[model samples]
Target: MRYLFAEYVFDTDRRELHRGADVVSVAPQVFDLIDYLIRNRERVVSKDDLIKTIWNGRSVSDAALTTRLNAARVAIGDSGDEQRFIKTLQRKGFRFVGAVREAKEPAEAIVADDQVEVQKVDLALPDRPSIAVLPFENMSGEPEQEYFAEGMVEEIITALSRFKSLFVIARHSTFTFKGKAVDIKEIGRRLGVRYVLEGSVRKASGKVRIAGQLIDAVTGAHLWAERFERDLADVFALQDEVAVAVVSAIQPKMIQTEIEVATRRRPENLTAYDLFLRSMQQYYLTTRESLAEAIRLAHCALDLDPRFGSAAALAGDCHASNVALGYTNDPQFDRKEAVRLARLALRIGDDDPDILSRVAVILAGMVGDSEAEIELADRAVALNPNSWRTWNNRGWVYTMAGLPEEAILSFERAIRMSPVDPLLHMTFLGIAHALIALRRFDEAIVALKRALRHNPSFLPACRGLASAFAHLGRDVEARAAAARVLEIDPSFTISAHIARSPKSPKLFIEGLRKAGLPE
Candidate 1:
């Protein structure tokens, strides 16, 4: 998004301030302050708002705040005395008084009412996630409901566009086929999107029903579909719910499709994304062999693209997983390597929520830096609140940091975001850990059972149930759970588990000991 005002273009996407044909040098804080003021130009912005936003809620001196504000003024060729572009209301707040207009991203534009312009061209799919939300058919016989259906598609498009991972095509391009009977695959080709969402909205007697489905454009397959019915009161709220539901479902489905495509690709045709996807598929299996293979694939991805932060972060996470699962023979070496890869990922992948989330968990568990890692975890969530993987990784980070209560909340949010995500069993295991830490054995047992139901061979969940049952004094059930663990992994031992999972709470290990597990 670019803001145009007074011979200056503030390019928010590129984080640049340009004047006509020249680039303007400005500090990061100054840029943020300017951007905030311009975005909220219709209202006043208090000092408290600036401090909370720019300083991340840290207190800042009045003098320091003034310095940053003044720097912003100079960058845009305005002055405190002139106050032409920015206005400071004494004892009140600041506002961007300048006239400002926003320009949509190039090749994207909104459609005006009663306007429909078809476009024709061949386009290549972008490297990142991309989608086109075609205007929904207004199945209602009433012409007024046409507005509702169009507005709902716009809401969904805006919601999806918020995630940094997605590339949403302009509404102008999509609305051309608004009333036309068109093929989904052809729309996908013209818009160059991997996925497309289409649906119909019906409004009658003060109630609205919407049905939406996401399609894998490449394979012409239905990836997800849902129906929603809501009251007409608070129409915006209903639209928001529909958007959230659709966005949440679309995200995980798109990634799963991509992962499957990558896994099926020939080795010689593998790109960095394919290797990374392959690694993620292996990483989630959570078995010793799979985790090792995930690590190998991650390293192979790094070899192809050393600056691939997601790949590097995945490698670091695999190391942490190895230590947690008792798969690594050299604990110290794994720790050191995890730390190294985490830092490298932090450097190269600062803008990516996935990398930040993975590195946060690795550092929280291995480096033992709870405060900093928690902040990093929060940053990841802040970067992309809609991403379930970030929230899931936050759960593990908080669990390892010994903040079990927070861990459970993060895990639950992740499941709510994408209930059928392939990594959902891992999230259930996280919830079980948090419950055990809280000494809620019954709840822990319930969570473990859920995890096992999802993946019966999931050793961690089985082991968790054994420990939880033992602590609850259900000796027979505890022994059965222990026997099941052994059945799953014949070489299991409490001593090795303790050595590998150094971050495990003492109570959990003690429960395992009481369960009569081999040591």
Candidate 2:
């Protein structure tokens, strides 16, 4: 029998794992563990069951079991951070949560190594925005520059990976095709990415040039292209600049492609990742109905694949946003559920910048756990300093901790990293809040207005605008901003808002009160 999911096939009878045409090496114990999980995928397998079956009731340490489970995950090109296949159910054991299809005949029989081989594996393109950055070519004649070119590609890959919206191919997997003449179509087929970034780096005479082109791998379309030249004196800085430019150039292209794909595809045909993407679009609208729908779609994705940490994090974020904006009357229940989901996300995605930022933002926004939120935000930045979301969330953490100067700097960094980000309003809103705490009413008003310009319906920005105007003695505009908040969220109350933002300044609260908000 064989079980297939995503790009992998598990041949139980052959006792092997295969990714496309390539066989993946796995330890004997890992193979056994995977086989057991797939066979028992309908239910969670307890630790005792694992020991009883895999170890034949032998005494196994907890550490040994965890190691085997992690090994099994790594063997299948999955990770504890993503949990794309195996999922831990806290107290309950583990389950294989991928969408699996099984066949009675062994996969080896259909794709035999001998001349009798007749079958092929069908590769499905990943549902989300996916890209593979091919190894950059060394145009410089020196052989030593080869290392520099490879390092450039690695840096770009790392930077692209910081955006959770993108499904970036790992450096090791992509480097496999290095130094080889390959067709982009074949590369896309093998890698299962919709887009490919191919580039060449030339470095010599204290100068460097990096040229990149973004290709629509499916249709062989040249979507976008750019070139960057810089001094080689600071190679690392040049690499960083090039990576940022490449990412900034391609982000909107990918998002436009995603919008077209989502519009054309029927809802029934959507995958978990597709649903997650759609949910994100809805979440960005920042309207009551849209947020509710976003939460529903996020849950739908979670239902399809319970191990999807990103989906869980997004769902938790929506719940927290509801409380922060006074959209929920049951703040206590919402906060509890948000915290629970955030905790699960942290457990599964400790190293994912997006997950860490989402968890941090939701916790700090709704629960106001200053120390814990700050730690998570700092960890996120440490993990991926190039990620705009990490810096943006860190800014909020600092704001909630009353460190206005640090908050302002962090928000500025976030904007510089991803100036055209859709969530730029959130960064602006954070800056306004920080400036308000610093008693810079004029600057705070400008920042709040900027946020409102980007996202008119964002209530936090409205709240900040009202407070800033009140502090600046602009009573008419302050009252108008306060009215906008009530129009968006009729249940708006100063007490509830203050509870969500526990570290907000007393003066900021007084300004809101002066703007005629209900106490």
Candidate 3:
């Protein structure tokens, strides 16, 4: 792949940089950095992201990173001050601001074999985990079942798209493969996804049978396969059921597979969707460093596709998390920026439950916009009631609004829907926080402990535990919890926390003050 920008041509296949017939002598790391920045020019690249990509996640000092970035700029006839090609964003990262065009390699005919090599595709893979649902094969004798099969595949695509975690190809793109014989490996390569879902829809008499298989597109390994037999009377309902079952069955598989692949590639080779998936994987850690990296990755995704609502929502989410957990001392600036991102996401993805839920949680929890948060939360629930994230977000809004009863109910519903969710720690923390508002110190302590058990480093749980323990007169435990909070986020101060948490009631704030957090 060749990228041309300004007077330079970067040959990714040759691993060379050229400017007006002059080959630039760049260090391996510098070349990788420039390549990454150019390939992902759609977003900002952070120092942490640089270390992860160029140094393979090794520790690198700020001065060293700055020097290397400077070297990269010099090699490309650019500089930090000039920023003709690379622009820096304060408290964010760096973006390749130069206009670029990708030159495609000539396409070759794809061979359908066990060892498949796909011809180059025009579209790049997304930064998030992506899957293409090929149009379901119509196996029934009657050709009239074509719409039934197409409808089922389209429904599945729509259902999968609701998951902020997975990137689902649109029906129009996937349907292009309808009635065609294609190689799974080629499909995987062309789609730039690790997994693919394919199935057959059969309607016989009054009954319907849907058989689906989830394949690891990279290795042609069958991760899962399922068949459902249901009444054909309610076609849409059956489609919904099959879609839900496929998503539930394959979600865990996709996560595990992505984790294995996460460390195998550099940013230069990743698509916008791949970057988004990487961001989400890191975001789940919920640590200060991880949040920074996640935010940077999310921004990179947005750069590749600025209108991506999920990426915008996650970017806002990271900003909100930064202030909510006291990761930053500058609450006002972070709050303003976070609200701006959330508003953009809301406008772009008004109907997307994933975006709506994230925006609602951030606006309600960090910005303290009760009306907007509540309305969005309600809309998210109505859009996808089965989504645990939607329920979890709604609970957050209620907790922030000081409605303990409603908050507790919403959290419980979220837990019921996704009992083993990695983020269950968050729901437990919400219940604990709400319990504190209700003056149930003992119950709150138990819930906080449970949350800590799931994720010991979760700062919100630690802070809540401290408050609950103090309210219960367990001074020793309270001090221990407060110490843990400091350990996770040394910048944490009661004043900063209070400023960010606009929805917290007076009683809840009082408990934290009693718990020995510095004002």
| Predicted structure with the largest lDDT when compared to the true one | 1
lDDT of 2 by residue, 285-325 (tens): 76777879988999998999887889999889888877766
C-alpha lDDT of candidate 1 relative to the true structure? 0.82
lDDT of 3 at 341: 93
Decoy 3 TM-score against native: 0.61
In Å, residue 222's CA in model 2 sits off its true spot by 4.6
Cα RMSD (angstroms) for every candidate in the order listed: 10.5, 4.7, 14.1
True lDDT of residue 494, candidate 3: 81
The lDDT-based order of candidates, best leading, equals 1, 2, 3
Give the runs in model 2 whose Cα sits over 4 Å from its true position.
1-27, 34-46, 66-122, 127-129, 159-167, 179-181, 221-224, 244-260, 303-308, 329-337, 340-352, 457-459, 473-504, 513-519
lDDT of 3 by residue, 1-519 (tens): 877654356777778776534567889888899899987886778878888998999988989988888998888767554455676665567778665667765312221222222223323444446688888898897898898898888777766666655666556446656778988887776655667899998888799999999998779999889899999888888877777676656665677577557657785866666677788887788887898999899899899887677889988998988877777657788788788999988876676788899999988866677887899999998877667789999998998877889999999988766666778898999898888888999999899889989997888888888888888889999898899988887877887777776656787778778889899
Superposed model 1: Cα runs more than 4 Å off: 1-119
Query: Sort by TM-score, best first: what order?
Result: 2, 1, 3
User: What TM-score should be assigned to candidate 1?
Assistant: 0.76
- Following a full C-alpha superposition, what root-mean-square deviation does model 3 have from the true structure? 14.1
* CA displacement after TM-score superposition, residue 17 of candidate 3 (Å): 42
